[model samples]
Target: MQQNKNDLQTTNKTKDSERIPAIRMFNLEDESSAFEIGSIPILMPTDATSFWASNKTEDWEQKMHPAPRKQYVVTIKGKLKFTVSDGSTFILEPGIILLAEDTIGEGHSWEIIDGNEWIRLYIPLSADADDHFIAENIG
Candidate 1:
């Protein structure tokens, strides 16, 4: 049987906390974009402006571009492979959230890996707000 998205995410979370898997793409001091593999609280509350949803992506999405703003990309369908400036990559799917904060550099790009449409929610974070991305492997 196919495991539920929540079940799959639980297998990758901290033992003491239930967090959804997440990856943050951000700008380094040199203005190059990088990513951290991590997770965020399952139900954390934060400030956000009007949100939007989309199932279609433009050709530019496959090319490198900075995020328009700090926001959360909540994917409800489709699997995508995102590549950062250093050529490193990660996969995003259900149960995984992407916090895109590299709004000023060669941020990242992605392409659909699964045949399903890229249905998603974009929640723009409030200015100067904390995104609460936990870099799980940080020392």
Candidate 2:
């Protein structure tokens, strides 16, 4: 018996998954905080429900603050320098995804970088599925 090329290819096949960058926020009883990660919110459509876009000139200086809602941010253009409460900083460029959820106390600060224009998408979380993320370790 001879082995076909398809058989050989199938035997060597590999499974690949998509992992997006994210900045997770937590609303503690006393204060709010944020963290950065390279992976987040399983690649499913149930949790992420709504989305909006922000396209504007990147010339504003935002102080430490929390996100207005629990959502995901997907960068489409330009860059942003984010600094968390832990004194950590991250530079986000195009194709980076950030999950912003710290809607409680002290959040994070960010400033536009690299260019004068920035575009991104804001995806809100589903109320029911939001709890799932709250209890799970996504990092």
Candidate 3:
């Protein structure tokens, strides 16, 4: 009986190890002029979840949905310029991270200054039972 229980625990650990890691990337469709262009993953957790290492770059301009949960933006690469709805701008560089509350309003904007390359990990405020956490929290 003890051996059977040990086997069951090992099996559960293997199953947990098989769980997917939530890391994603966005790519530009065309290599034309600097325009509002980037890719967003289709599968994003809603509640307080966490992302490992992710990267994004945009030559033009773009907006990020205010996080449904508080967010930590960690920059792993080039410069990223952020503009909030209140007409405030922040420039972030590599090895820098910022924390902000998920608030409602006009939202925030991003632009790549001097060619932007940023790696970030997003930790959501709730558990990700499903992707529905994002919908339930943001919407």
Candidate 4:
């Protein structure tokens, strides 16, 4: 019985380690922003102050700028191509979560890759909340 319990515990631990689809834009040591192909936990409880949705300008192409604050960006419509300071790029869509933490330095930019309009939600996290981001096993 104890052996079975231990096996179950190990299985649960493995399940918890599985990550969901996510992308992280973070400030690097040189004070420039970069992109990481990573994931947040399967279920992360975040403390957020508020959330708001927006449809950005017609241009739909942003120049380099940092995020206003640490937040989660959920794209509900339109596909986007995000480029960081290092010229690394990633495509994002409705099913992926954007962990925007590059609040300083030259951050990142994005352009609409699919439709004309890009609509998204910004959820600003509390100052002490955990982001639960993990960068590993992207290959």
TM-scores of all predicted structures: 0.85, 0.69, 0.46, 0.81
Lowest summed lDDT window (length 10), candidate 1 = 11-20
Which portions of model 1 miss their true places by more than 4 Å? 1-17
Tell me the tens digit of each residue's lDDT in model 3 across 67-131. 34445455667676766554556676654444444344444567768663556665544432333
The candidate that wins on lDDT is 1
- Give candidate 2's TM-score: 0.69
lDDT of model 1 at residue 128? 84
Candidate 4 lDDT at 61 equals 38
Candidates 3 and 4 compared by TM-score, better number: 4
**Residue 51 in candidate 3, Cα distance off native in Å:** 2.9
Residue-level lDDT tens digits of model 2 in 1-139: 9999998776645211334445565656667575645454355554675688988533333787877887777888888888877777878887556777777677888888888777888788775564233323455
lDDT of 3: 0.46
Please list the residue runs of candidate 2 whose C-alpha ends up more than 4 Å from where it truly belongs after superposition.
1-16, 41-43, 57-61, 130-139
Residue 62 of model 1, lDDT score = 81
Give the alpha carbon lDDT tens digit for every residue of 1-139 in model 1: 9999998777756553677789999999988899998988867787886899999879898899999999999999999999999999999998899999999978888988998589999999998888988888777
Question: RMSD to native for every prediction?
Answer: 7.0, 5.8, 14.2, 4.0
